[model samples]
Target chain A: DMKVTQMPRYLIKRMGENVLLECGQDMSHETMYWYRQDPGLGLQLIYISYDVDSNSEGDIPKGYRVSRKKREHFSLILDSAKTNQTSVYFCASSSHGESSYEQYFGPGTRLTVL
Target chain B: QQQVRQSPQSLTVWEGETAILNCSYENSAFDYFPWYQQFPGEGPALLISILSVSDKKEDGRFTIFFNKREKKLSLHIADSQPGDSATYFCAASEGMGYKLTFGTGTSLLVDP
Candidate 1:
């Protein structure tokens, strides 16, 4: 089955702590994205990864970083967790070229920074 | 600045009724528009999409009506059912594989 998986569906961290959210896909898609969704603000893009080791910052990348060491895996890291960072995180993957416009999303990770 | 915007933060409709969700964008460069449906505790999923070249696209009971000149679009759900109740978001992107700018979603309730 084609699917995107996110680990630690829920996480709670203290302020200033380092946090890691992992995502994996089985479709071998070349493009992956990380987004944070909050009430009223909707889904805000955090990062976009085009294949292994090629990542670009999205509009809301200030407090987040991403790693894509493999085509099927993408990780979102928060260097120093902040209370403002508490939100639901989503990971998505898509193929290259024409089909890149369609993204398949994972279940999502709900993170709480206290 | 919000590039994409949605109207009627929330809407309630009876089952089998037609529900309309409105969306508008500010950037002229945006060429691809897509609507997503998200249920509570789940990530958003693509519902329907329309390109600037096409004025309308239909799939089953969902249709997207686009007006490129006005930089606006709307999603019409025909015969809406309780199962279709979810938050709907409007999003736009300028180029292929580019990050999408999303609008604050419209919470839809289809009461049976």
Candidate 2:
């Protein structure tokens, strides 16, 4: 079955600490995305990776960064965790061609910054 | 500013009743609309989608009604069941655009 997996399903970090959330997909999809879902904000995009080493910032990219060193892996990095950064993060993947815009999401990572 | 918006922050319906969730977008460039269903502590899953070219699309008991002129769309759930009681989100994107703009979800509750 096609699937996307995220590591560290739940995380807690102190303010100003560095954080990393990992994601992997088996479908070899070319496009990967990172998003943070808040209470009334729905899913706010953080970053979009087209392929290995090709990443673009999304609407809410101010406090986050992403790395896509391989086709099957994508990582979201928080240089300095802040209390306001606490939210559920989701990783999604999709092909560039046939499944142009349909994204398959991972279980999600709930991060709490104290 | 939120490009996509959903109405009726929360809705309660009885089983076997039809539940209507409304959505509207501000960007005219958005042509593809999709609805996602999310349960607590889980990721959202794709439920149904519609393109600007088509006015209606149906799958199983879920239907999407689109209005290109009004930049609005809605998801109609026929015979809503307790299993279908979950948060529903409306999302939109431009043609071939990899990014999607999502709206604040509409929470649904189906009483048995």
Candidate 3:
């Protein structure tokens, strides 16, 4: 079975601190995505990596940056964490080719900024 | 415009009852629709999906109803159990290699 692993199930950071959320997938999927889930706001895409070193901004990319140094790993960085940035973050991977495909997601990381 | 829209932000039902979750899309180019289910503290998982060419698809108790003309679809959970309590999200995509637009999600609570 394909599995996506995320580091630090829970995190608490101070305002202006740098935060890094790590994700690794065993499926070797070509597409990876980062999303934030907020109450009543739903899941908003933050970034997407099509391949190694290839990153694309999503609708909500402000205050966030992403890196995919390797095909199996993707990282989300918060250069300066703020209170408004606290939310549950999810990492998803898909093996979609020419046809649309389903994405497998990680357990998620809940981050709190104070 | 919100590409995907879901109704009944929250719903509660007794065990064995059928729960219907509705979803609609504005983009006519959307050819693939997928329903995702998420439990508390976990990420959403692909529960079921259907294509534009198909009107309905079923997997056990979960069924998808599609209306091409209306550009709407629905998820019907038959014989819902307490374990079914979770949030369901509906997503749509136009074609391959594209990002999916997701609905706000509907919370379903199945009481025993």
- Each candidate's B-chain TM-score, in sequence, is 0.97, 0.98, 0.97
Return whichever of 2 and 3 wins on TM-score: 2
For model 2, residues A1-114, the per-residue Cα lDDT tens digits are 999999999999999999999999999899999999999999999999999999999998998989999999999999999999999999999886764467999999999999
Could you tell me the lDDT of residue A76 within candidate 3? 97
Q: What is the TM-score of each candidate against the true structure?
A: 0.97, 0.98, 0.96
Model 2 chain A poorest 10 in a row by lDDT: A94-103
Please report, as a residue range, the 10-residue window in candidate 2 chain B with the lowest summed lDDT: B92-101
**What tens digits encode model 1's per-residue C-alpha lDDT throughout B40-108?**
988888898888889999999999999988988999999999999999999998864368899999999
Best of the candidates, DockQ = 2
As for DockQ, the candidate ahead, 2 or 3, is: 2
Model 1: CA > 4 A from native: none
* CAPRI-style docking class of model 1 based on DockQ: medium
Segments of candidate 2 deviating more than 4 angstroms = none
Error of 1 at A31 (Å): 0.6
* TM-score, model 3, chain B versus true chain B: 0.97
